[model samples]
Target chain A: MSQHYYEFFCPVKVVAGKAALEHIPYELSGLSASRPMVITDKGVRGAGLLDPVIEACEEGGQEIVTIFDDVPPDSSKEVVRQIASAYREAKCDSIIAIGGGSPIDTAKAVNILVSEGGDDIAAYAGAGVLKRPLRPFFVVPTTAGTGSEVTAVAVIADTEKSVKLPFTSSFLLPNAAIIDPRMTLTLPPHVTAMTAMDAMTHATEAFTCLAKNPLSDAHATAAVRKISTNLPRVMENPKDSDARLELAQASTMAGIAFSNSMVGMVHSLGHATGAICHLPHGLCMSLFLPYVLEYNLEAIREPLGELLLYMAGPDVYATTPTSRRAETCIAAIRKLRDQLWQYCELPRTLQETGKVSEDQLEAIAHSALDDGTIMFNPKETSIEDIRNVLRRAWG
Target chain B: MLAKRIKPMALQARRLYVETMFQVMGRALQAVSEVDRSVQEEARALPDGFLFEMTVMPNGPKLVVEHQGDGRFQYLTSEPPRPVDLSIQFKHIAHAFLVVSFQEKTSVAFANDRMLVDGDIDRAIRMTRILNRLEAFILPKLIAERAVKEYPQSLGLPEKVLSAARIYLKVATHFVETARAS
Candidate 1:
């Protein structure tokens, strides 16, 4: 139990393993939905991820009324509106999001519109605005990262305003998350590495950040252990179904953990860097995780040290002295990153990406301070401190 | 029967503290807008005529303020005629007291899920920064350090003392006027 008062919530039903995708139709029907609008991206579609999903639905005698697969890598308000229109035009009674973060977020946004009766998502922006349950929503995550499937938040870019609009509510959670290894089997090496690291970061932050409760710690530690043991094996053999399934389940557990406990400075800086440098979200998480742990070392040492057993297993954990466990945890994360870089050229630093300039570090720092996630960081950070971290991460 | 009628809302001591804190916080927003450069910068970043409100849920003390552009703010004596751009509602009076009495920093209170904000989060973050700046200026350094995430390092002791005096005087006058009005 936490000494401080805390609240934990994750109502999304998780359906994982080999038969997960096949069970989606049954889950949708349980919600009294036979007509589902499938939302995904071209990448997942092109990768033939939809074939099995379509086959499953058809075999179950549930029709996918329509599919809007043109979703951009970053879901936009306009795209959401368009999907809402198509969802209405097609008379979609439910939604099935079959991709990564974008499509799932877009589905949640579309569910808001169709269920709540609104086209302008900006009207519903902010926390606790959705006052009712959304339409039947199911997620089939094609990637192992971005626990958007179980999370209660969506970030849709408002292109006209040049700002990311965040919509948060427990209502945004999917009715069920279908985590089938078949869907993620086609994920490229780099994406697999980064997305797994994203899960790693989520679990790490959830365990150490403020708002952490006993329940969240359970999920976070389990996720960390799963990812720590399985990520390397999956990277070595991308076709390993068991490893892939473990990774996917770990991602969902991490999602549940972070959704309740919430993330901290890693996410704040990662979001800022993504906005400024256009780096992938997972890559930013990987780049910033170690540095932030080092920065919040004093405040979060006990929890960080406790995470060593989960992250590095008993051998390393038992060997490391109590005084050095926290630093050893960070070293273990750095070691994992080094291993990932070898597996796939996942950039270890901002400079290696050939995208972020030194001059942009100040802007990133400023932007990060404005981020809501910063409030959850164990250590209160100054712009100078953030800039120092960014500079160090710049390599 | 009378004993049973005494409800949680009738906890007079907590109510008085919450009301007094809200009153002082309202006045302090007005004073800091005039005195603190950082508050002004934050106000300018907000949308024009942005109304910010802080209240406790289930009918507790409420404090409302408006951004009058160019780093100026006005404390509304009554509930605003229009919906606020951002509103942070503490789940209970005790939670509000925890934050108001410097027992919990605003960021910590937020992280602890003691409060809920309705409206733009970015603007809410901006408002929190403004509140942090106000706390740094008005509260004692030792207390302010506990109430805010980071105490402004550049705020010298002399400047803090001088601003705290001016702000407290304004707060005192505001309360006096409220007393007379009531």
Candidate 2:
């Protein structure tokens, strides 16, 4: 119904495949940068992912001034400030973020501070605030999740205010996202399953949300089909480089799709859950996918019907009546979660996580209402409505 | 001292005309939607104390409509008398008039990055539904076809002429009152 007006933007040049890691320096050369700072987290380092990145940089003849690998799970403004200070001291001309969401997000904020020459990055909060392009930046995600590589939005926690500040603009997008399957080869099966489901949520919710347009719809549908085909294959063999590349490409496409159309209540509730429980974001995303689909079913049955056609091939799709498409989509999502749970020991409910407590339900429900993504959801999501969904998903 | 220069994207003459038109339509819509035997159930489903604002942004010449709880709305003065619960902000003057001047459909304008919503989503939805009701009354069949998701039931030619005349007369009276008060 909201098809009346929409605009899509994804300027990130994505390099995806087994050999993509070797091309990072060439791409950075295209951005005219020779000295780049490598930003990562301890988890990525402990997993021995940073060594290959360093070797590849050396092989590309690009100088690395410093490897600042202190990013926490949720990047804060203070951390970004510190990272920016390091970038300056090292005289790095560009940033190369290697890891999951946190390092990529920290690099985005650091680019803002370093380029804008502002000590108070908080002044750049909210949507459309960044007017100028940022320093040449790139990301190499270690997990097939969070598509932070291509999105034009960054969430940095304001440790002082105890709130998350969202900075959005075309400027926040990275110059390139290198998706080498080697980057995620070390990722555990559980992380692979959960993050793949997160990508599925992004693809499905982007398709069904109010901002859906022709361009984003194609990307979202393609992302869903890719994730559906490759998730189980990667789960079966975590070391398969080809399967890893497929899932990684799926995340990038899904990220670009959701970045353009934005997401709906699944993301809103997931953010609330992650904020309240300090749980892994992908776990929270996978847990809420089916429930949010059902909640939005009545309002967006047409889009959901279309998604059923994407997720389920024409064989099953043709047999199902048009009226049953929404149900089929919801069932398919639940089936996927069940498969992941049985195969990988992934938690299907919030209680199974053991990090989330029953007392946190009210706070999660209240916080979800404050999340901005709910605005794009096709259905009206009230606080009571979020509370009910949380209760049902709480197990 | 530097003189203040107006922003290039500031709301312009066309936007003012659009505001004036909405002021007229704000008063006319409730009565028109309430006309007997209309099945646009959502059009007349507005709650009491609801406030809708159309702001031409980043700075705005904002126009507001407040539901009076009697199946009617009144256009408040340039400065709203009360807090606006929902604000639909156009990116600039060009976008503001594209819908306000009937050159583009409201929904289409929204999809085209012509506008942004800054407040409650539910109230925005309700206001869009109400605006469609007014569009049915105000716009010609060709324009209304593009504007509304589903066309409201048609009024006969004889009734259409009479209703249009009556609605404009009431709108004229209200517009004059607004002008004098301002």
Candidate 3:
């Protein structure tokens, strides 16, 4: 048996529940942030979730110098830098990121750029590139998905190059995460389904990937089982506080799992596909999950089978061989995607996205080949295999 | 036959580390009588009617095993005993157990102070191996059951509400997933 060593660490204080957003002042107080920058996107502001947070902070004697609500979807480095400069100009002592991944990630980038005084966000790309911690950052995720509040990585698109720069470091982890399902109550059905599937993919990949260890396995398994059970419910009833809580918890757990154990090809292909096609990351992930799993079955069967047992329950594994379990898991995932697609009206194929084509398959595959995540896949993958997976995902 | 008499709670307690401390121990003890016949035969050999005192502490849980039969047989942790035996510091039990289960190395964790064992070194090694097998077979089921009970609605939700919730969760889950995948 191969002896695998694993360590789990997510020190960010997670404040979760129905009115968990109210706990932000307490978390920020602990960080000694007197004047915090409330970083968010227009969507969150438009939804009016920022009001209570601002009110809560004001009631707690915390001053908010600026509300940078310019963050856009798939936030670019230019936007982050602009915000960072604004934050610095305002002399804000800390950051309070409120929204989905884009704003949270943009806040992380802003923290890095402002604190480290770097002109180019690209200079800090890759793991362990940062020499010091960023600002004292507190994250409140408006969406129930993306557990960006706790992860130690950020993705900022470079519009000039059309490439997403992934800056990773332990230092990028937020000081605290407030995951209140109420923040996600107003989210539309399509966004909810896609983000839930994104959370599911995180848990699934962490459970079945090569780098998975005991701690990650525990978190991933719990996350997958929870998301599988709760995502649908939350999608069906956004007002169901309990289901919303479960998805929030699943999102955080999946975040913790993949952050520690890492993810696999589904993500690699998704990243490349997202960057190239300008499709949403979750949409790309949901579209490619089954195809990539089908491609990886030969190498990932054993673990994937274990995951299948966790996902579909033991009955599915009772008569199936371990090697066959992987395929079954892939089929199960595809079935879920199909169900989700019908429910959310999400695009089921690359062609449905209106941008991707068979002609770009090679480029997408090549980009995936160069992605850092592919290196951790259980099976060795090549550009050719990636091309094949893309073609299959094209439907 | 004596093993048949062992309370279901005791069996579940034996499998406590598997997942939820409550459910696994409950199931293992409930099913104990049917699966392993040797447990009863071994229980017959225990001293004081197979009574074993167990103490779970921060370091490690300790069990004082006494023999009721002729000195030829030894008792450990309410189970039948083998030839060798050892005691571990209570705090290191879980760590030691995990290391032995995954690494298949009994002494390194103990020697490195990640675990500490007292008594016969040989017995400690044997116990680790047994615990490894016990964890592997029992943990997954326990974990699965716990997850199922924890989140029952994941199968499918009402179409109207599910459609709405999907949008938010999709964005959130994607942002985190893509970052980690990268």
Top candidate on lDDT is 1
| Superior by DockQ: candidate 1 or candidate 3 | 1
Q: Each predicted complex: what DockQ? A: 0.63, 0.14, 0.02
Best by TM-score: 1
lDDT of 1 by residue, A1-395 (tens): 42287788888888988877889888987889988999999999999999999998899887889999999988899999999999999888999999999889988998999999978988988788899998999999988889999899998999999978889999999999998999988899999999999999999999999878899999999999999999999989999999999999999999999988989999999989998899999999999999999999999999999999999999999999999999999999999999998989899899998999999998899899888888889887778889889988988
List the candidate numbers ranked by lDDT, top first.
Answer: 1, 2, 3
Stretches of model 1 off by over 4 angstroms after superposition: A1-3, B1-10, B150-156, B177-182
lDDT of 3 by residue, A1-395 (tens): 63445557888888888677677777777877777899998889999989988887778777688999989887887898888888888999899999988898898988898888867888877555788877789888877667687798898888899766778788899988887777777888888888888888888888777667788788889888887777778767778878877888888899998887777889888988887778888888788888878777766777888888767777787877876787887777777777777777788899878888778888788677656566456665645678788877888
TM-score of each: 0.94, 0.78, 0.65
lDDT of each: 0.90, 0.80, 0.68
Q: State the lDDT at A281 in candidate 3.
A: 82
Error of 2 at B175 (Å): 9.2
**Model 3 ranges with Cα > 4 A deviation:** A1-3, A118-126, A157-164, A314-324, B1-182
**lDDT pick, better of 1 and 2:** 1
lDDT tens digits, residue span B1-182, model 3: 66776766665554455233322232232222123233334334334433232233462344444434432122232333542233445343455344423432322333223433434222343333332222323434333322221122222335323432442344345345546876
How would you encode candidate 1's per-residue C-alpha lDDT over B65-170 as one tens digit per residue? 9888899888999879798888899999889988888888898899889999887676788888888888888888899988987687888999988988988888
